[model samples]
Target: MEDVKDYEIKALKKQIFISNLKAWIIGIILVAEIIFIGSFFSKMGTFGEESLSENKVAVVRYNQEVTEEFTTTIMERMDEIKEDETYKSVLFIMGSPGGSPTASEELSEYLKAFQKEMPITMYVDSIAASGGYYIASSIKPLIANKNAIVGSIGVIMPHYNFGQLAKTVGS
Candidate 1:
């Protein structure tokens, strides 16, 4: 009976030890996760603050689609420009074939508003067609090379019909 009681006590001690170990491990993981997340957020905040502080000339290049994020970035940049007195003007170096109509319109309106506050100039390096031209035209003195493809002044919906090819393949 004495030996049995001792064994039972030993088992209970082992069980308690395992439980405490698990608790310790879980607590360590939780603390690590919190630290990692805190550091990540701190780095992101620093990056955002630095980007806002740096001198920036908004360049909408290539087939860069103008989405809400793009608009927000532009707005933020405009605010940054306004806040900095040393930054004289905003130059939009546009090099795009254009994107969503609504996005383009929003960007154009925002640029117009910025222009009202400060001098806004657009230098079209390459083809600023369709919606790209739309935004550029809104600017006061639109500068573009003579050979540059300037105006597609229209919208095009490109589609491909593979019906014939599919029929030939037995789909």
Candidate 2:
């Protein structure tokens, strides 16, 4: 009976040890993945301009569909940059299909005004079509990636006539 109990205790200890080892391995993998992803995004310019240092390039990452929200966020970022003497020029990292042509035009005007104070440049990494180009066009000497798409300068007004379909279906 004593020997059986010793064997059982040893098995339990081995199981617990195996469980802890597995957990540690998983944790290490998770940490490694996070580090790798962070490095990739860091090279891609990430999203925040707060990290820009004094006398360095101030980056405004706009990666959303152009809308009132985009306008508000970018305008606020511009205002913040205006006060900071830490940047010489503004680098806009734009990527979007864009929205609301009027808003884009308005934002373009605002960016133009801001450019009057400090030089503004745009770097379109991904899709910056439609209203996106509208805003980007306002920037003088716009810089873009070799494969970056810069087209579809137009507007979309989603209008549907489902009434005819409903009538035909006799709902």
Candidate 3:
């Protein structure tokens, strides 16, 4: 009889140990998820005090190379501003040397669509060349400094034939 009682106790202890371990693992996972989500949201913004104001102005600064990441960040910011009714208009500040043609085209289209919802005014700080100028051209009422350089807009695709060089080198 004693042997049977000992066996039952051992089974219960094993079950309790497994349940406690699972609870600990689930708690750790929840904490990790919370940290990851918080960091993601924190890194995804350019707006500062203005975004929190009663009647905010979404200030988008295009002061970097217009890559896919840049375009994505701008699109996300625009979407966020659109959802928040507090944003009255957009102040698009520009200073770019231009970058990917595809990203530029994508951004231009998004800006045009965003314009239908809210007013977007552009201001050129220093320069806006190539894809940069291409994007700025979409927004209306653009204000630039008298000396600010704008519009050296064009796209170039260079093709190279290295086969001849490789053959000469006997590769």
Candidate 4:
């Protein structure tokens, strides 16, 4: 009888321990998921004080090389701000080595047109060369990081020699 009682108590304790372990593991996973989701949204400007407000400054981050995708995203954001009718100014956050003069010019034209009604600012951090600078030209309020490289304003006619690269890589 004494031995059986002891065995039952040990079994119960083992079960409790296993359950607690599982609960802790699940808790940790849930916390991890929450953190991941929060950071992801935060980076995408989906939360915080960055939300659009009437007459508030709108910011568009243009960090990649100037391309059609960059132009499209800028245009979309600009359109969003235009529809809102309250954002007083648009800030172009620029850091690009620049590419595609045609793309840059199209974006430049859009910014110039938008500026007729809403003010635009250019904040150049790190670098804004070539096409990047071209787009920033129309924005009246230009701010730059002291150490930023601001020029290389010109066109690049691309002609690639991919034969060597293709031979090196089995693509």
Cα-based TM-score, every candidate: 0.53, 0.60, 0.62, 0.61
Task: Write model 1 residue lDDT over 73-148, tens digit each, in one string.
Answer: 7678778877776566777777767767887798889888888887878888877887778878889888997777
| Candidate closer to the true structure by TM-score (higher is better), 1 or 2 | 2
Give Cα distance to truth, residue 6, candidate 2, Å: 32
lDDT of 2 by residue, 60-124 (tens): 98788889877888899899988878778899988878887777988899999999999888889
State model 4's lDDT. Answer: 0.85
Best by TM-score: 3
Model 4 spans with C-alpha error above 4 angstroms: 1-53, 157-171
Candidate ranking (TM-score, best to worst): 3, 4, 2, 1
Tell me the tens digit of each residue's lDDT in model 3 across 75-150: 9999999998888999999898899889999999999999998999999998888999989988898898789889
Sorted on lDDT, best first, the list reads: 3, 4, 2, 1
TM-score of 4: 0.61
The runs of at least 3 residues in candidate 1 whose Cα sits more than 4 Å from the true structure, single-residue gaps closed, are 1-63, 157-171
lDDT of each: 0.75, 0.84, 0.88, 0.85
Task: Specify the highest-lDDT model's number.
Answer: 3
Give the Å shift of residue 59 in candidate 3: 0.9
Summarize candidate 4's per-residue lDDT along 54-114 as a digit string, tens digits.
4578878999999998689889989998887657878889998899888999998998898
